[model samples]
Target: MQRTKVKELLAGAEEGKEVLLKGWVRTKRGNKYVTFIAVNDGSTIHNLQVVAEADKFSEEALKDVTTGAAVAITGELVASQGKGQAFEVQATRIEVLGKADPETYPLQKKAHSLEFLREIAHLRFRTNTFGAVFRVRNTLAFAVHKFFNEKGFVYMHTPIVTASDAEGAGEMFRVTTLDPINPPRNEDGSVNYAEDFFGKATNLTVSGQLEGELAAMAFSDIYTFGPTFRAENSNTTRHLAEFWMIEPEMAFYDLQMNADLAEEFIKYIIRYALENNRDDIAFLGQRLEEEDKSKPQQDRQEMSLLEKLEFVVNNDFERVTYTEAIEILVNSNHYKKKKFQYEVSWGVDLQSEHERYLVEKHFKKPVIVTDYPKDIKAFYMRLNDDGKTVAAMDILAPGIGEIVGGSQREERLEILVERMKGVGIHEEDLWWYLDTRRFGGCPHAGFGLGFERMVQFVTGMGNIRDVIPFPRTPQNAEF
Candidate 1:
């Protein structure tokens, strides 16, 4: 009487049991003796085959059973005599819930490019590729909360709009309710934010690390997982205007502790995905392998997607100082042959190419590069005793590169104020944040992992845009 999910039926539903199955038709084919309809309800990657005998159902009753059409069937579960699936259904009654015209349907039984799919994001979820991608994304997201909960960390929901720019990059989407054409103005003819909402300038937060730190001061261990926005105009495959971030701030955690937790956290989630979504991962891996066939042998990935994930989980990430990383890069044959697109120097921030070289070529595994120069890093990172570098670290993954960026926070009030002033961040803007140090400050550390990047890494999706649904980029925001 009740509908059964395709996943449950396929898992091990009792044979000969009468069941009601509801799902969209993936494909329908028959030789006039019987109709075999492959149906999927998004429960699992595989489809449940519904066999409708020609004698039992007239031609008119099955005429609308096309791809993308929704259907309901009352059938008897039976051991499948087919090659691929273990079990299928023998339909006794059929109902076409909805019909999709085969001629007009954008998605048919054929390959569609990722670019084309982006244009029709609203319908892309119906595709097997996207279905698998989102399912893996779901598993990884749940794993994040589980990992933190098991570690006794409080999940903190930080503000999305704030007056302070955590990264201090000066690229933020302004949040204000004021006339853009002509409205409030200062004596200097500049736009006056004092007359705007919040009574001061505010923007979509670029990172929750600052607010996360405030919560961590009280809770001792907290993490924020939410949407973060950036106003960067870049249209790269890796850059998105709006994305999700996972930031975990911990009290009394030094740089080493931060790195250790990050390493453990990454491996835990990857292992979780592998354990729970093996079929999906395998599908993506095969998809990637097929895609890689078009590229030159040299440019193709050395390892398959599954192999890369397993390698990261089984192996320990190589740890090196920023200076040591630079040394390794400068002396390497890739650097000598001028293969690197960016220069490798002591103070210069390492680019994606350099990070990938360290992880993919030199180390052949994940690497934690630490103690970067203060000039290139944010003001909040703890200054090293040498006064040249900060207690910062970045976890570089093989293909993705720089999956996690974090550092030990500067708990000393005087030093923090000085660093803020040097970066032109007025103390007035974040006095509440400074209060933690003014009262009872201790050494603390945290890191931020871009959620989409993590999904991209796990799914082996080359473009960051493909991993996230409804990606907001330079000039694209289509659903």
Candidate 2:
């Protein structure tokens, strides 16, 4: 009596056995004698075909079995005579659980543009492309936890609301419960945050690395995976207003150890996805190939999606210092010809173009650039002996620039206090963060990996908005 998922039925559920299956109809086609219905329950990329005899079910009884309609069918499993699939269901009775009017259902038996699919994101999951993308995303997320758990890392849940800016970028979403039109004000006409919900200023956390550090101090090794928000108004294919981050803090890790762990961690997750979700990933690779055909030959990716994943997993990432990377960029033909839009200098931050050049053109592999200029990096990164560069590192992939960023944290209280003062972060605002260094600080290092960026990398999705379920962007928050 219970309904079996289409996946199970297709995965060799005993043939000739009567079974009940339920799913949404992906497509329905037939002549006067019979109807072939493709049903998919999102268990896998492929759909299960159900054959209904014209004599058994009259046209009136099967009127509601249209595309996008939810249906339950009681049938006998048998070997499929179809060329592509292995097995199918021969329906004896079909019930329309939810009827989708054929005249109004938006999803028809045709290809739709990715831009148009974004408009109907709520229903996009039913499409093959989105279904494949989300399945691979699910695999990657689970693989992240699994990799950390196997390494004895505790999964710590950090607060969503915080008073300190971890990145110090000053692009955080303010969380307030005060009236916007007319509210309490100070003597200088400034908005009073003392009476606010937290009794002081607070906003959605930009990164959980600070709080994650507190837990790492005690737990020895900890990681935080959660949502972070930014109020930046930039609209780009790579930027997202709200995104997820995976930050892992270790009590006694140096820059080298941090880089080693990051390398292992990235490979582990990618290997897991390739092992567990090959079908879904293969589908995405094909989708990318189709999309890339429209692009010019020069803009097309050098390697396919599967090839890129395998390359990252099997190869070692070339490691270089920020100085060396800058030197390489400065001497390259790309830089000599004045092709780089942003200037390439030792003290300046590396742009996406520079990062991509280092990975895709120079190294032809993933690269880890380390020891960045102290002025361009965050205040928390430990200052090197030269006092001009910080012990920071960023992992740059062929397609995605700067997939991971981390550094050895400043453990000396005196130095940390001086760095905080230099950056204008008051000692009072981050007293707790300082407490880690004040009391029992040792050499500690950690790094943050943008979860959506990882998804974008693994899935080969061009737009950052396509990977996340509900993208929150400037002037657009539609479902």
Task: Give the alpha-carbon lDDT of every model.
Answer: 0.94, 0.93
lDDT tens digits by residue: candidate 1, 80-127: 998889999999999999999999999999899999999999989989
- Backbone clash total, candidate 1: 0
**How do the residues 11-62 of candidate 2 rate in per-residue lDDT, one tens digit apiece?**
9765889999999999989989999999999999999999999999888888
Worst 10 residues of 1 by lDDT: 7-16
Residue 411, candidate 1: Cα error in Å is 0.4
- Candidate 1: misplaced stretches above 4 Å? none
Q: Which residue pairs does candidate 1 place in steric collision?
A: none
Could you tell me every candidate's TM-score relative to the true structure?
A: 0.99, 0.98
| Alpha carbon deviation, residue 402, candidate 2 (Å) | 1.1
TM-score for candidate 2, please give it.
Answer: 0.98
